[model samples]
Every structure is written in C-alpha cells, then in structure tokens.
Target: MRVLLTGATGFVGRGLLERMSALVNLELIAAVRKPVSGFPENVTSHVIAGLEADTDWRKVLDGVEVVIHSAARVHVMHEQTSDPLAEFRKVNVDGTLSLARQAAAAGVRRFVFISSIKVNGEGTPVNVPYLADAQPAPADPYGISKIEAEKGLRALAAETGMEVVIIRPVLVYGPGVKANFLNMMRWLHKGVPLPFGAIHNRRSLVALDNLVDLIVTCIDHPAAANQTFLVSDGEDLSTTELLRRMGVALGKPARLLPVPSRLLEVGATILGKKALSQRLCGSLQVDISKTRELLNWTPPLSVDEALRKTAKHFLEQQSK
Candidate 1:
C-alpha cells in the first residue's frame, strides 16, 4: 500500500512515519510544508506550502492510497488572531475539506483524520464517558472546527464513494509530549507540592504509539470505513493516581498535599486561575468500546510502560 502522511514533523506524525517506514509492504510519502531531513530512505518528502483552502494537492495525490491528515491549526493557549474561529476554519475545516475533495478525485481510497475529544465536549459526567455517536458539543473554536471538518469529510465521502475514518483521541502523550503533560512531569520531577491528592476526577489519555497503531489499522480495515471512533488506552486515571504513577516513572516522590477539591477550586478562582483548576479537578473520560468492538484493536502499551518511556525521554532531554 502507498500512504501519504501530512504533518510529518509533528509529534504523532513523526512517530507514525518512523513506524510505517519500517513495514516492508508499505510505501510512505511525507507531505511537509518545507524540506525536512532525517527521514528514512524508504520515505519520500513532498512540499506543499500553506496547506490552506486554495492550496493545490494534485501534485502529490497521484497514486496515494491512504492519506492521514494530521496537519491543523492546533489549539492555542493565548490566541493572537482577532478572529480565532475564522483562522481555525481556514485551515482545519476549509483546508481539510479541500484536500479530501482533491484526494477523492485523485482516487485516494481512504482519508483518516486526527480529531480531538474536545469535539465531544470539555468534560463528562462522572462515570458517563463520551461515546463515539454522541451529539457534538464543542466548547472551543478548535473543537468546533474539527466537528465541522468531520461533517464535511462525511459529506464528501458520500458524494465521491471515498472512505473517511475519523479518530478522536483524548490527550495524546508520549516521549515528545509537551504543554500540560510536560508541565506536570516537570513539577513531579522537581518534587513540587501539588494539591491534587484529594481530586478524584477521571480522565482518559492515549499514548502516541497506540494512536498510531489505530491509525494504521484504519488505513485499510474494512470495518473502519465511514466511521467515527474514539481512541484511548482503555484505562482511566484520576489526577492523584496519574501524578503518583508519573512520579514513580520519574523516580521521584509525588509530594502531594491532601487539599479539599472545593477549597482548591475556590482558591484558584480567587487567583484568576479557574480554568487551570477545572482542568486539574474535572472529569473527561471517553468510551472506546465501539472502536474495539468494530476493529478488534487494543492499545499495545499500558499506561505505566508509556509513562516510563515518556519520563526517560524527559530526563534525557533535561540532562542535555
């Protein structure tokens, strides 16, 4: 099979490229914004700048069987654009639909889109996880754009007889993870006193390896066509348990203070960090039973094993 992967330099895309390149039966082509080095000899790199709605994909779409579309205007902490929604739509919704149209016309068999669990909503009721068929209730502009893009892809699939597989993953983490997951690891490594010991909210997360494996399966799996699936590690963790496990992986003490969840929320609100507090104390779980039942897939790596790899990489990078 011949596959074209976008965002080849990104965290998930890079991992996918490395793993897929090693397969003897597959030929890989990387669609990047600019020239990149260090890819395996078996992989070919093609440059297509901007990746916007007007960008032409005819040059690279020929003979491409599967296209894993991972490039997007990702979520930002502090959005600088005046119209954040418009900016996200320009790339995520418009650009994605444009590529799918051209890929369908070019005879591409399957297009796998990497979406976020945010499309299901920010948080879920306790023990009531978000399902793949739930009505989308996006809370942010990025999530809104992803849902819109998914809708467009489904419509295009119906019109063109092309297959569309959408995978919505929750909080992917691994060796090259950054942002909030990295910050938590840093805090645990430094032995900072955290007030999350009493929080019992559950959150689901996916390992990069596991997500990549699922992506590869969807690339050719007959049951995956025109389906929306939620991807996770099949294990949910509370904030306190997650910190404890990460601390063990990092070979450090968690040093957690048993502060009441309500007190912490009130303090955070007083300090104008309510959003941060909510992320730490809220529940956001996803149900992947549908994905497993449909594709007979399970995450290959356990949470502890994945975290150990993540911590080892973090320590190595810190030493450098």
Candidate 2:
C-alpha cells in the first residue's frame, strides 16, 4: 500500500512515520513543510510548504492509497489573532477539505483524519463518557474547526465515494510529547507538590503508539469507511491518580497537596487560568467501545507501560 502522511515531523506524525516505515509491504510518502532528515528506506519526502485552501496537492496525492492527515492549528492557549475561528478554519477546515478533494480526484482509497476529543466538548458529566456519534459541542475555535472539517470530509466521501475515517483521540502522550504534558513531567522531576489530591476527575488518554496503531487499522478496514472512532488506552485516570502514576514511572514520590477543588478553581480564575483549572478538575472520559468492536482492535500497550515509556523518554531528553 502507498500512503501519504501529513505533519510527518510532528509529535504523533513522527512516531507514525517511523512505525509505517518499518512495514516492508508499505510505501510511505511524507508531506512536510520543510526538509526532514533520517527517513527510513521505505519512506520518501514531498515538500508542500504552507497549507491553505488553494495549496496545490497534485504531487502529494499522486498514487497515494491512504492519506493520514494529522496536521492542524491546534489549541493556541493564548491566541493573539483577532479572529481565531477564521484562522483555524482556514487551515484546519479549508486546507483539510482541499487535500481531501484532491485525494478523491486522484483516486485515493482512504483519508484518515486525526481529530480531538474537544469536538465532543471539554468535559462530560462524571459517569457519562463521550461516544463516537455524540452530538458535537466544540468549546473552542480549534475544536469547532475540526468539527467543520469532519462535516466537509463526510460530504466529500458521500459525493466522491472516497472512504473517510475520523479518529477522535484524547490527550495523546508518549515519547516526544510537549506542552502541558511536558511541563507536568518537568514539575515531577523537580519534586514539586501538586495540589490535585482532592480533585477527582476521569480523563481518557491515548498513547502515541496506540493512536498510530489505530490509524493504520483504519487505513484499509472496510467497516471504517465514513466512520468516526473515539480512541484511548482503554483506561481512565484522575489528575491525582495520573500524577501518582507518573511519579511511579519517574521513580519519584508523589508530593501532592490536598487542595480543595473550589479553592483551586477560584485561584485559577483569578489568575486567568479558568480553562486550565477545568482541565485539571473536570471529567473527560471517552467510550471507545465503537472503535474496539467495529475495528476489532484493542490498545496494544497497557497504561502503566505507556507511562513508563513516556517517563523514560522524558528523562532521556532531560539528560541530553
């Protein structure tokens, strides 16, 4: 199979690129903005700079059987742009549709879109997990753009007979992870006491490897056509429990303070971090039964194993 992968240098993309390259039966084409170094023998590169509605994808879509699109303007916590939605739509929605249209024209078999759990809303009620077909309630511009892109892809699939698979993953973490996850690891390394003990919230997270595995599965699965999936490691954890696990993985004692959730929320609001507080003290569980039953797949790695790998990678990077 010939596959074209976008965002090949990104966190998840890099891992997928490496894993796909190891498959002898697959031919990989990486569509990246700039030149990348050290690709495997089975992988080739296609330089497609800026992503926009008019960005030509003729060359990149050539003879590509599957297109795994992982590139998008993700959450900009402190966005400086005036019209954030327009900016997100231009790249996430318009550019994505442009690629899908060109791929359909080029006779591509499948287009796998990597979406986020934010499309289902930031958090759910305590025991109510997000389902694949749940009504979309995007809470931010980035998530709204993803929902719009999903809508467009479904339309394109219906019109052109091109298979489109959507995977909504939650907090993908593993080697080469950055942003909030990285900061948490850093704080853990420093033995900082986190005030998440009293807060109980369930969050679903996927390992980078697990997410890539499911993406590969959706590439050719007949039942995956025009289907949406919610993927995770099949495990849910609270902020305090997650921190404790991280401590175990990092070989550190979990120095967590028993802070009240209300106090934390008020403090965060005063500090202009209401969103962060919600994330730390909210439930965002996903029900991946649809993904498991329809695709006949399960996460290959356990949560503890994934966390250990993540912690090891963090330590290695810090030592370097």
Candidate 3:
C-alpha cells in the first residue's frame, strides 16, 4: 500500500509514521510544511507551502492509494487571529475539501480523515456518552470546521466512488505530548498540589499508538468505507483517578487537595479560566463500540500501560 500522510511532524502523525514505516508492504509519503529529518528509510517527505485551498497536491497524491489527512488548525485557548472561525475553516474545511477532491480525481481509493470528538459536543451528561451516530453539536469554531469537513467529505464520497473514513478521536496523549496534557504532567512531576480530588468527571482519551492502529485498520478495512467512527482507549477515567494513576506511573504521590467542584469552578471563572476548568471537571466520554464492532479493532495498549509510557517520555524530555 502506498499511503500519503499529512501532518507528519505532529504528535499523532509522528506516531503513525513511526509505526507504519515498519510495515514491509507499505510505502509512506509524509506531506509536511517544512523539511523533516530522521524519518525512516521507507518514508518519503513532500514539502507543502501550506494547507491553503490553492496549494497544489498533485505530486503528493500521485500513486497514493490512501490519503491520511491529519493536518489541520488545532484548537487554541486564546486565538490571536481576528477571525478565528475563518482561519480554522480555511485549513480544516476548505483545504481539506480541496485535497479530497484532488485525491478523488487522482483515483485515490481511500481518504481517512482524523477529526475531533468535540464535533459531538463539548461534554455529555454524567452517564451518557457521545455516540458515533449522534447529531453533530459543535460548540467551538474548531469543532464546527471539522463537522463541515466531514459533511463535505461524505458528500464527495457520494459523488465519487472513493471511500471516505472519518475517525473522531478524543484527547490524544503519548510521548512528545504538549498543551494541557504536558502541563498536567509537569505539575504532577513537580509534586504541585492540585485541587482535582473532588472532580469525578469521566473522560475518554486515546493514546497516539492506539489511534494510529485504528488509522491503519481503516486504510484497508472494507467496512470502514463512508463511515464515521469514534476512537478511544475504551476505559474511562475520572479526573482524580487519572491524576492518581499518572502519579503512580511517575513514582510520585497525587498531592490533590479535597476542594469542592463548585468552588473550583468559581475560582476558575474569577481567574478567567472557566473553559480550562470545564475540561478538568466535565464528563466527555465517547462510545467507541462502533469502531470495535465494525473493524474488529481494539486498543493495543491499556490505559495504564499508555500512561506509563507517557510518563516515561515526559521524564526523559524534562531531563533533557
């Protein structure tokens, strides 16, 4: 199989490249904005000016049977752009559709898109989880753009015979992780006391390896065609339980104070961190049964094993 992968320098993309390169039957093409170094021998790099609608992708799509679209404008807590929605849509919707159209014309067999779980909603009720077939309820600009891209991809698939597979993944964490997960790991590594003891909200998270595993499965699975699936680690964890387990992996105690969730919310609101608080205190579980049943796929690593690997990497990076 000849697969063209975008966002090869990103966390998830890096994981995919590392694993897919080892497959003897696969030839990987990494589409990156800039030059990437130290990739495997089986992988080829193609420099892209940007993921704009005008960017030409003829050479990248040549001889590619599958296109794994992972590049996009990720969500930011504070966006500096004047029109965040336009900026997000430029890459996530317009660029994505342009690429998919070109891929379809190039006779690409399958186009696998990596989308965000935020498309379902910000969070679900305590006991209710987000299902794969749920009506999209995008609450943010990023999620809205993803939903639009999914809709466009599906429409394109209907028009063309190309298979379109969409995988909506929750928070992905692993080695080289950054943003909120990295910050939390830093706090835990330094033994800073946290106030998440009262947070009992369950969240679904996917390890980079597990997500890559599913992407590989979708590339060849016949049933994955024209399907949108939610991917996760299968095991849900409360905020406190997550912190405690992470602490265990890092060989440290979870120095969490027993603070009320309401008090924490108020404090976060006063500190202009209401959104951050919600992420830490809200339930955003996903039901990934469709992915498992459709592809006969299961997460290769358990949550605990993934956490330990993440902790090891964080420590190594910190020591450097």
Candidate 4:
C-alpha cells in the first residue's frame, strides 16, 4: 500500500511516519510545508507551502491509496489573529474539504482525519463520558472548526465513493510531547509543590503510539469506513494521579498539596486563569467502547509504560 501523510514533522504525524516507514509492504510519502531531513531512505517528500483551500495537491495525490491528515491550525494559548474562526476555517474546514474532494477525484481509497475530543465538548460530567455520536458542543473557535470539518468530511464521503475515517482523540502524549504535558513533567522533576492532590476529575489521554496504531488500522479496515471513532487509553486518570505517576516515571517525588478544588477555581478566576484551572480541575472523559467493539482494537501500550518511555526521552534530551 502507498500512503501519503500530511504534517509529517508534527508530534502525531512524525510518529506515524516513523512507524509506517518500517512496514515492508508499505510505501510512505510525506507532505510537508518545507524541506526536512532524517526520514527513512524509502520515504518520499513533497513540499506544499500552506494548507489553504486553493493549495494544489494534484501532483502529490498520484498513486496514493490512503491519506492520513494530521495537519491543522492547532489551538494556541493566545491567538494573534483578529478573526480566529475565519482563520481556523481557512485551514481546518475549507482546506481539509478541498483535499478530500481532490483525493476522491484522484481515486484515493481512504482518508483518515485526526480530530479532537473538543468537538464533543470541553468537559464532561464526572463519569458521563462523551460517546462517538454525542451531540457536538464545541466551546471554542478551534473546536467549532473541527466539528465543522467533520461534518463536511461526512458529506463529502456520502457524495464520493471514498471512505472517510474520523478519529477524535483526547490529549495525546508520548516522547517529544510539548505544552501542558511537558510542563507538568518539568514541574514534577523540579519537585515543585502542586495544589492538585484533591482534584478528582477524570480525564482521558491517548498515547501517541496508540493513536498512530488506530490510524493505521483505519487505512484498510472495512469496519472503519465512514465511521467516527473516539480513541483513548482504556484507563482514565485524575490530575493528581497523572502527576504522581509521571513523577514516579521520572524517578522523582510528586510534591502535591491537597488544595480544595473550589478554592483553586476561585483563585484562578480572580487571576484571569479560569480556563487553565478548568483543564486541571475539570473532567473530559471519552468513551471508546465503539472503537473497541467495531475494530477489535486495544491500546498496545499501558499508561505506565508509555509514561516511562516519555520520561526516558525527556531525560535524554535534558542530558544533551
């Protein structure tokens, strides 16, 4: 099978490229914004300036069987654009649909889109997980754009004969992880006392390898065609538990204080950090029962095992 992967250097995409490149029966092509190195010798590279609605994909679509799209205008802490929704739509919705349409016309078999769990909602009630078919309640512009893109992809799949597999994954973490996950690791390594020991909120997180494995399965799985699946490590964790486990993996102690969740929320609101507090103290669980039953899939790596790998990588990077 010949596969074309976008966002080849991104966290998820890079992992996919590395894994898929090792398969003897598969040929890999990477679509990147600029020239990058260190890819396997057998892999091919195609440079496209940006993911705009008008970006030309005619040349790269030739002889491609599957396209795993991981590229997007990812959410940021402070967006500089005046119109965030429009900016997101240009790439997330419009650009995605444009690529799918062109792929369908070019006889591509499957297109796997990596979406976010934010499409369902920012957070769920304690124990009330969001299902794959849950009513969408996007809280921010990025979430809105993702839901819109999913709808457009579904319509396109109905119109064309191409199969579309959508996987909305929760927070993905592994080696090379950045942002909040990485920061948590740093704080834990430094023995900084965190006030999250009392946070009992359950949040689902997927390992990078697990998510990549699902994408590979969707490429040829008949049951996955035109299906929306939620992906996660079967186990859910509280913020306190997560930090403690991460500290253990790093061979350090997690110095967490038992602060009241309500107090934290109140302080955060006063400091204009309510959103950050919600992420730490809120629940965002996803139900992957459908994915397991339909595709007969299970995450290959355990949470503890994956965390150890991530910690090892972080330490290695720190040494260099």
Candidate 5:
C-alpha cells in the first residue's frame, strides 16, 4: 500500500516515519514545503510550493492509497498579526481542502487528518471528559483553523466518497518534542520551583508513539470513515503528579511549592502570565472510550515510559 504524509519533517511526523520503518507493506511518500536533504531510504520527499500550486501533485499522488494531513500552521507563541485567524485559515483550511480534492481524484482510500483537542475546547472542568462528538468551540486562532478544516474535510468526504478519519490529539508528549512541555522540562532540569503543585488539574496527554499507532490504524480501520476520534495516553495526570514523575525520570528532585492557586492566578493575571498559568494549571482530560470500544485499541505505553523516554531525549540533546 502506498501512502503520503504531509509535514513529514515535523516532530510528530518524524516519529510516525520512524515507527513505520518496519512496515514492509507500506510505500511511504513524505511532503514538505521545502526541499529536504536526508530521510529514510524507504521514503521519498516531495517539495510543495503550495497545496494548489502549479506543480504536478499527481506525480506524488500516483498509486497513493492514503494521505495523512499532518502539515498545519502549528499553534505556538505570540499572535502574528491583527488577523491571525485569516492567515491560519489559508494554510490549515484552504490547503487541507486542496489536498483532499487531489487525493480524492487520485482515488486515495482514506485521508487521515490530524487535529487538536483545542478544536473541542481548551480546558476541562472537574472529572468531565471531552468527547469526539462535542461541538467545536475553538478558543484560539490556530484552533479555529483546525475546526474549519474539519468541517471542510467532512464536506469533502460527503462529496467525493473518500473516507476521512479525524484524530484530535491532546497535548502530545515524547522525544524530540517542543512547545510548552519542552520548556517545562528545561525548567525542571534547571531545578526551578514551580507553583503548579497547587493545581489539582488533571490533563490528558498522548505519547508520540501512541498517536502514531492511532494514525496508522485510521488508514485501514473500516469504521474510521467519516468519524472523528479524540486520543490521549489513555490516562490523565494532574499537574503536580506529572511534574513529580518528570522529575523522577530526570533523576532530579521535583521543586514544587504548594502556593495558593488563587493567589498565583491573581499574580499571573496582573503580570501578563495568564497564558502560561492556564497551561501549567489547567485541566483538559479526554475519554478514549469511543476509540477503545470501536477499534479495540488500548494505549500501549505507560505514562512513566513516555516521560522517561522524553527525558532521555532531552539529556541526549544537552550532551550533544
């Protein structure tokens, strides 16, 4: 079977590529916006000018049965413009539609779209779990684009009869990872005392390996068509517990001070650290029951295993 993956140079994409190295039945095609120098011998890279650019996408789409749309304007720091949503929509919404159309025309069997839990909602309250069927109430510009893309993809599936599987992953963590988690890890290594111990928030997190496994399953799972799945590590961890474990894995004493959460939140609000506080002290747990019940899939990695592997990667990087 032939498959194509966009954003193949990214952290999550790279993990998926590495994991698929043992799949002898798969012919993998990786797409990046610019030319790449090194990749696995089993995969070929195609540089794209734009999703609907003049270049012949058919060449890459040839005989490809699945398209994993991993490329997107990823949610990161700082608002770029007054109209950030418009910019995000161009790449996330418009670009996705273009690729789906081409894949449909090429008779691709399935299109697996990677979305974020942000598309569902940002923070969870108490013991409630975010369901796949939840109405999207994206909180940021990046999430708005993903939600728009989801709507477009569903329409494409209806129009072209191509199966579309959407996987909404929550706070993916693993080796070679970046963003907020990485920053926290760096701070932990530096032995900083974080006030997050006060937060009783439980958040769902997905390991890179677990997410990659789900992506591959979506490619062939018969029931995945026109369905959306919310994924995690199949267990949730409180901020204090998560940091303590990470500290354990790093072989460092976890420096957590049990400061009053209300006082901390007030200070963060005054000092323009609200976003950071939200991330460190918020809850967003998901129920993977739908995924488990339907595909009979269980999260194969333990949280400790995931955290340990991630810490090892960071240590290796520092040594380099």
Candidate 6:
C-alpha cells in the first residue's frame, strides 16, 4: 500500500521512515517542513506550505492508502508570541483537517493519528490510569490542539465514510530522543544530583519501537477503526525507580539528593518554572489493557533495555 506521512522529519517520524524504507513494494510520501539530508531514494519529499490555509492535499493523497500523521507543535517553553493557541490551531487542527479531507477525497483507506497522553491530562493519579474513553482535558495549548484534531478527524470520518485510528502514547523514549528526556540523560551521565528521589510518582512511558509497532498495526487493523488506544511500555515505574534504572542502563551511579518536595516546588515557583516539578514529580499513568487485548501486542523491549539503547546512542554520538 502507498502511504503518506506528515512530520517525517520528526523524532518518531524518523524511526517510521527508516522502517518503511526497508520494506519492499511499499511507497512512502514524506511531507516535511525543511529539506532533509540523505533521504532514501524510495521516499518522496513534499514541503509543507502555510498550514493555516487550505492547500492542495488532494495532490499528495493520490494513491495513498494510509496516512501516519506524526507532525505536531510540541514544546514546553512558550517560545512563540501573539497567542500560542493560534499557532497550535493553525498546524495541529487546521492542517490535520485539510489533510484528512483530501485523504478522504482520494479514497485513502485509513488515517492513523498519533496523539499525546497530555490530551487526557498533564498527570494521572495512582488509582486512576487514563483510558481511551476518558474525557479529554488538555492542560496546555499543544494538547488542546491535539484533542481538537482528534475530534475533527472523527467528525470527518463520520461525514466521509473513512477509517480513523487514534493512538495516544505516553512519554516515548528511544535513540536520538531530544528535549527533556535527553537533557535528563545528559545530566545523569554527568552524575548530577537530582531531587526526584523523594517523589513517589508513577509515570507510564513507551519505547519508540513499541510505539512504532503499534502505529504499524493500527494502519490496517480491523479493530482499530474508529478506536482510540492508549499505548505504553506496560511496565510502570516511580520517579526514584526510573532514575535508578536509568543509572543502571548508563552503567553509572545515580546521584539522587533527597530534597523535600515542598522546597523544590517553592524553588521552581520562585524561578518562574511552569509544570517542571509537576511533570517530573507528579504521576501520569495509563492503562494499556484495551490495546493489548485487541491487538495481542506487548512491548518487545523493557524499560532498562530501551534506556540502555538510548544511552548507547548518546555515547556513540559523543565519540564522534
């Protein structure tokens, strides 16, 4: 089947690209923001025009059987000015709708949307793991846009008689992982003391490979149409336990300083930090039973193995 993928230059998209490139008899249309270097011969690149306007998605959707949308505006820091929601709406909501409409017009078989767990909430408690049926309560503009996109896609599916599959992954980590997790790994590699030892928060995380596999299965799975699934590593870990395992994966000792949670919260507030402590110290757990029961899929790698692979990638990068 011919597939068109948006955000093919992103973190998860890159892995999807590598996997798709090795497959025979399948064509990949990669829509990217910039001109990428060293793209494979099998893949076709399309630069995204203005996201807000209704561009010609019909051209790219031609002969495309499936679409894996991995492009999004994900950021912790509000670097953009003059309304963040407008920025998020333009790309995540508007662009997604335009693409879906054209994909439907071209009779694409399936649309697989990769959304974040933040669409449920910023954090979850120990007893209540967020499920696919949970009411979406996005905590930030980025997440709000994702929720809107999901809603829009579902409505479009109803109107156009197209198949829609939504998979929400939590904290996906792997090789070439950028942003917060990468920084944390760097700090751990340097043996920096972290105050997360005292926090007993359980966060659900997904390995990149596992997430990619789920997406692949969702592309044409009979059970995935009009279904939303929460995908995770299955193995949940507390803050301290995660740090300890990360240290083990890195082959280094974790320097955890037991600071009071209140003190850390105060410090974070004084420094104008927004949601750092909550993200690090608070819990965001998910239930993946629906995903497992439907697809009979389990994460092939454990958290330690995943962390080790990520560390190895960084080490290899350091050597060069």
Q: Comparing candidate 4 with candidate 6, which one achieves the higher lDDT?
A: 4
Error of 6 at 161 (Å): 1.0
Worst 10 residues of 2 by lDDT: 34-43
Q: Which stretches in model 1 have alpha-carbon errors above 4 Å?
A: none
lDDT of 1 at 198: 93
Q: Estimate each model's TM-score.
A: 0.98, 0.98, 0.98, 0.99, 0.96, 0.96
Give the whole-model CA lDDT for all candidates, comma-separated: 0.94, 0.92, 0.94, 0.94, 0.87, 0.86
Model 5, global lDDT: 0.87
Per-residue accuracy of model 6 over 1-320 as CA lDDT, tens digit each:
89998889888998899888878888999997777878899999888765544777777787899999888777747465778888888889998888888889899989999998989989888757998888999988889999999999999999998999999999889999988888888888899988877877788999998898888888778988999999989988887888888888887778998887678778888888748877777789999999999988888878888888988998889789
Question: Model 5: which residue pairs collide?
Answer: none
- lDDT per residue, candidate 5, 20-105, as tens digits? 75688999999888988768899888888765323457888999999998988886577757888888988898888888888899
lDDT of 1 by residue, 157-237 (tens): 999999999999999999989999999999998989998889999999999999999999999999999999999999999
How would you encode candidate 3's per-residue C-alpha lDDT over 1-320 as one tens digit per residue? 89999999998999999999999889999999998789998899999999999989998899999999999999887689989989999999999999999999999999999999989999988879999998999998999999999999999999998999999999999988999899888899899999889888899999998999999999999999999999999999989999999999998888999898889989999999999888898899999999999899999999999999999998888889
Residue by residue across 1-320, what tens digits does model 4's lDDT show? 98999999999999999899988999999999999988999999999999999998989999999999999999877889899999999999999999999999999999999999989999999899999987999999999999999999999999998999999999999999999999999999888999989999999999999999999889899999999999999899999999999999999989999999999999999999999999999999999999999999999999999999999999999889
If both were scored by TM-score, which would come out higher, candidate 4 or candidate 6? 4
Residue pairs in collision within model 1 = none
lDDT of 6: 0.86
- Native-referenced Cα lDDT, model 3: 0.94
TM-score, predicted candidate 5 vs. hidden true structure? 0.96
Clashes of 4: 0
- Residue 106 displacement (Å), model 5: 1.2
Once fitted onto the true fold, the runs of candidate 6 whose alpha carbons sit more than 4 angstroms away are none
